[model samples]
Target chain A: MKILFLGFGNVARRLAAIVTDEGWPSRRGTFPVEVVGLFTASRGSLAGAVDLARARAELEATGRFDARHPLRTDMTPLEASRNLDYDVLVELSPLAIEARGEPAVSHIASALARGRHVVTANKGPVAFAYRKLAALAETQGVRFLFESSVMDGAPLFNMARVALRGCRVEAFAGILNGTTNAILCHMERGGSLEEGIAAAQAAGIAEADPSHDVDGWDGAAKTAALANVLMEADVTPFDVERRGIGSVSVGEVRRALAAGRRLKLVCRACRREGAIQTSVAVEEVAADDPFSLVDAYGAILRIETDLMHPLVLTQEGPEVMDTAYGVLNDLMEIAGTAERKGEEP
Target chain B: MKILFLGFGNVARRLAAIVTDEGWPSRRGTFPVEVVGLFTASRGSLAGAVDLARARAELEATGRFDARHPLRTDMTPLEASRNLDYDVLVELSPLAIEARGEPAVSHIASALARGRHVVTANKGPVAFAYRKLAALAETQGVRFLFESSVMDGAPLFNMARVALRGCRVEAFAGILNGTTNAILCHMERGGSLEEGIAAAQAAGIAEADPSHDVDGWDGAAKTAALANVLMEADVTPFDVERRGIGSVSVGEVRRALAAGRRLKLVCRACRREGAIQTSVAVEEVAADDPFSLVDAYGAILRIETDLMHPLVLTQEGPEVMDTAYGVLNDLMEIAGTAERKGEEP
Candidate 1:
């Protein structure tokens, strides 16, 4: 199989490493695949699989590409995506929550328009236009899979979509944003929010500008995406009743901890009567609840369904590796579908 | 689709209710299917889909059949299985751990021989004869799925088999037996082991004879089944380095609780030096650990794999409804496979 990557960030690079180290997963088994093209907004583009660590380092240090690399290209992602010979298009672009899934949506749509399968880790397309993009994929005879959008590599969406065939997902509550949780935990330990952000940023767990996470936009976007896909809410991130941890004080966190409860910015989506309701706000979780126990870097999702009982899926200390796993798993799903129909990988 | 149930018990009745209330899952959509047959050891057999409430009541009250029942028969499951025309076999037979998955294994083999798909909740076939039974199903071009055999309806195995296709499961540690966890929790709460068994039995979570659970055989069986399928351990429950909570003392439980730890009967299976090692033993979990917070009736499984992060799956207060979902989901999987191949369901 040949592939084109939209953004060559940490996630895309991690996936590239997995395919090179562990090989690509397909219906038959794992095997090597060609990484035909790689694109990035910061570092220009590459035409073939080549060592990218030095390129990323030089771009970070010099704020520009080395310009001497043999595979360097001036071609845009759109140009490579349309002209490249590849069976799958991997979209690992940074999320644009405020833009409401913009260029990423166009990229995925272009790939699906050309009858190519898409495996993405971006939340923009799902939160803003799940139904339309999914319909486009179906119309073009391909798949649009995003397992890393919510909780990286957790497979919560796959559980609802594939393994849970007969059951109907009635509702969900999750601690979706790790940055906010880390901020809260830091405050509980008598530190300020800035200190928490700095700590997380140093650990590579939070971005330099964490306005989206601190303002609950990231959690709201994930909530909208999950609700739109699983509950068919047909809603966007702005539709959710949202709040952030900016209003939560250190005294409040310490008091909640003293009372054997933890303050969490909980993202919840449920059906009330016939309409779907989404919310992201700070809530006090009891000591015994599973959500109260997850660390700052951990995530937990509780799903209430019809036939199956309420299931709680948790992943603690998840890093970039987990997000890359989601991309690879989605690719494997597409390949498995094709192989079932006797198509070449 | 037509189904033949090998053992008509609470689980089978629960599935019947799900199909009747929520409808059967298929490639097309939710639709009703025929429950062509129901076979039981003590209550005799029924030839068609009959209201079984009165029959089950009668069997429990008087332990005999009312000759006036229209669909009543003395036909053995084997006899009915041989002569019946059905697309799938729903096996909810009781576990015969000491028998090493007997009668269930033989019955499932017969169904596979007849080229019929099988969905089972019994652990016997998985613990003792997974390879042979799976091979037989493949030879007959059918599926032999046993999701309920391990985690009720949590979908841990499904995550490994269907979703996490490319990644390999490196190891697993779980509180696989709910009864044992319940017992340990009860003992920690200043109750005796006998009181714990009584509480679980009162809640209908434990069998009348709790010997298998207290002896650690149940957890060992689940460990072996999980290791065999996920890690290719190829060993039985007896092969595990096993111990039961029966030897746990009340003083020990209280002391552990006082020390900010909870003693749990943890079932662990890992690949050590290219060989799978399975063990079930009592371990102390710190207060900060997620396992320390689960209630007596709750279950927690932490799976370690390559690519994907460590996944922790937990289910609390699961009832017969969840197990029924497992069987239905497996049925839907078979139907999905058939639908992909354009075969008549």
Candidate 2:
């Protein structure tokens, strides 16, 4: 299948590598994936435009590539739509929430309008305009899958829709933001709030301007997407009550640890008397509990149901890669089925 | 949608109550499910037959019975097929493996042949003849879902197919047979092997014969289903190395517990050096490990993948209900999509 990748970030790079390596093992053995084109946010050349020349030189010394994937920087959505004959579009562009007229949203919307399936890691499009985008996909008979938008690649979307079938999900609670969770873990281990933030930054777990993750916006975005898409709840990011790890102090962390408890940034959404309420809070988890042992940026979803006991699902590690692969897998399933049906009758 | 039930067992009774009462809340809220017909093996009149009487009593006790949803007994497969006008068949008959050539298989085959989706809790047809049955369902363009055949209702089948998508499952290890797991849990708590077996019988966890579960054949059957259907590894029950929990002595259990370990009847299927091998054995799990905490009939599937970490999923109670619901859910998704498409151009 001919594929077009939008953006040249970490996820985009990994996807490019996986698709280009023919003999690489997929979960189903060595199936080859061909990447026909890549479009990045640059011009001149990634090698020429690199302000960090030393890092570029070190990367070039390895002989992998003198430059990154080719950047079609000047191509507009309309031009790309007419020019590219790709089967699917992989959208990995960095999110732009304030710019309601961003290129990523237009790119995705245009791709679906052209009846091309979209596999996206961008949460902004879905979180902001899910109903419009999903309805558009349905009308065009193409899939608009964004499995990575919620929990990286942990099957959180699939679990809600498929695994917990025939059961009403009353509540969904989890540790969503990895940066905050990492900082909280450090704080619980006797580090001051500032020290923990510094540790997270040093470990590359926190962004330079960490307001999105540390101030609970990231978790709220994920919660909105999950609730709206998976649970079919009418909600938005602004609807949730946001409380990040920024409120917790060194004294509070130490006191909790002394009481044999660990502080965890918890995100939860539930139907209360037919109204949906969501919040992110730092809760003290007991030592023997599973949440206490969730080390780093791990995520756990506790779903409350009526028929059976509460189902607790815990997923650990860097989930972005898994999420990317999940999006690819869904695309494969949808595309394979569609291709087969087109060939039949 | 009219549903035809093939048996009047506990599961069938529960499902009938849910359907007739329309009390079960779906994604669209409490929608009515009308049960048009029911069939049981009893020969007496519909009102007097033991199975029919029990079903009626249960439905009445739950206050879910309506005069519109009448009961029927002594209905042959052809008679019910012609009379009911049901869109789906719920097969909950007592599994008669000895009579492989009997009407249960033929009835199921005919139901699928006539384009009625089949949701079964019966293991007889699937364990012995999955290939033929699955091929028939494919030919008929309907689903043959038997989630309860393996783990009562704990999303085991769906988990393998959907949740763990895009990853090569290297191995599946679990305590599949609940009766044996219950026995082992009791034995680990200082009861003798015989005493534990007796307790299992008293608690209705084990059958009177108890050979199928305790002798490891039950777990072997479930392992075969998982391997064949989930992993797409063509395997039969006979291919598995069956070792029942009966082999584990009381002294061994005591010794294992003394060493801060608990004995569990473990069923494992893996691709070892490119060859699929499965077995049931007594493994000593560490006290602090998740496997050790699986008490009573609870089952856990530790799926090893090519990814960075293994996923451990535990289902705490009767798994058959979840499996049955999974089958129903799959049918709903497939059928719902088809119905919607049929409405379109």
Which tens-of-lDDT digit does each residue in B14-101 have in candidate 2? Answer: 5544444435554432233445566666522132112434456855575443344445345575567555666677777755534642
lDDT of 1 at A71: 86
Q: How big is the positional error of residue A327 in model 2, measured in Å on the Cα after superposition?
A: 1.9
* lDDT measured at residue B232 in model 1 versus the true structure, 0 to 100: 70
- State the DockQ, from 0 to 1, for candidate 2: 0.28
lDDT of each: 0.84, 0.67
The 10-residue segment of model 1 chain B with minimum total lDDT is B22-31
Tens-place lDDT digits, model 2, residues A1-345: 556666556665555445444434544522334454455565212211222233234334553333544432455544564467776777887656566426777888888898887888878777777888889899998778887776676666666656565567777778777888888778777787778778878887677877778788888777777777756676667777888878789888889889988888888888888887888778898765656756777776666665455566666565556655666556555655565566310
Encode model 1's per-residue lDDT on A1-345: one tens digit a residue: 788888877787677667665334442356446677878898767777645455455555776555776888898888787888889999988779878898898888889999999989999899999999999998998989999998998888887776667666789999989999988998999998889888889888788898899999999999999998888789998999999988888889999999999999999999898999999999999988899988888999999887777899999878999998888888878777888779888
Residue-level lDDT for A161 in candidate 1: 77
The TM-score leader among the candidates is 1
DockQ (C-alpha based) per candidate is 0.60, 0.28
The local lDDT score (0 to 100) that residue B220 gets in candidate 1 is: 88
| Total clashing pairs for each candidate | 0, 11
**TM-scores for the candidates:** 0.94, 0.81
